[model samples]
Target: MPAGEVQTDSIVRDALNCGKQVFIPYIYGASKKGTTNTNIKSMMEMVKLNSLADYESLQRDRWGIPAIDPNTFDQREHVLQTSLEKGEGLDIIFVPGVAFQIDPNSKLVKRLGHGKGYYDSFLHRYQTKFHSTGQQTSQLKVPPLYGLSLKEQYLSTDDEMEVPLETHDYLLQGLAIGDGTFHNSTS
Candidate 1:
């Protein structure tokens, strides 16, 4: 995690304390070579973390962010696995970005990640897998994605800077800044 990125400790704690199911990104197969598709080479899975103790027990990855170790954690439930079994996916996902811009009129949030397309690729995979099962769209739960940003990461509507968006990039439903401010896209 960078210095200006939104911290997840409080959010994780609150979600756990409220008895909400928590899942963290577990990236794998990143080192594979000879794959043209980046998504195929590097895959990410949202694995369930049972309790606050589980959250606390996480080991820090290269970025110093707490992450679940696949080698050690044997009984992991993937988000897709849960969705397939229970017909319910995540309700919300707090995305981290390097920069964010909100449209003044539409209120749509555009995000710029740190140049790694992990989240975008993960989302694309999720949609493809869920729809491929021939399940009803209503039955398949697609969560509203929100961006978590620090004050420095957000660009005001008045600012001239733009967050360049790619075709595969996702628009956030809302944004939560570090100062506890909420910017709802629908509003």
Candidate 2:
């Protein structure tokens, strides 16, 4: 789903209820290709800040208080690390992007995010952490990562572009549509 229509409140509530620490990648501007900064601020408020005023104060004055930036590797790493620490490890990540697809073989989902490769970098780091801890096999039980999308943007099998195999493997999930439609390669 477009970040604007993701129903962040609902997703956050669900994750919190399930004892999942939610890490949402917030986008910066009109790119409209990832979770917008506004949405991220809103989510922080809903989950940690407790109020708009609290969020504003933190953003306005907090030095080194991680902010989202798709192009900077250092910034991305810092944000991921900070979120992981706050949540005790990212159990669920709400990614934002323009398009996504499911790969039947790898059972992975691919999201067409912005040009920066922030998502890819974050995923790589996360997987590395999982692997280094020798929990890769056990952690693999996490279901296919679901790519949120809007109804009108759904692509059919006949779509011209083939999602790269590497991208598919990175996600190893499925796609979720805004109108309650869920598509999976296995399905």
Each prediction's RMSD to truth = 2.7, 9.4
User: Can you write out model 2's per-residue Cα lDDT over 1-187, one digit (the tens) per residue?
Assistant: 2233344556655655666544444433433334555533221211232233322333311323333333432333333344334433444455555666665456566666644566666566565655555443443432245677776555555688765544323563567788888766566
RMSD of 2: 9.4
Instruction: Go through the candidates in order and give each one's C-alpha lDDT.
Output: 0.81, 0.49
**Superposing every Cα of model 1 onto the true structure, what RMSD results?**
2.7
lDDT of 1 by residue, 31-116 (tens): 53234666466767788888999999998877789998777544788876665456666778888999998966677899999776
Worst 10 residues of 2 by lDDT: 41-50
Error of 2 at 108 (Å): 4.0
Best by TM-score: 1
Q: For each candidate, what TM-score against the reference?
A: 0.87, 0.55
Q: What is the lDDT of residue 102 in candidate 1?
A: 91
Candidate 1: give the clashing pairs. Answer: none
Q: How many residue pairs clash in each candidate?
A: 0, 8
Cα lDDT of model 2 overall? Answer: 0.49
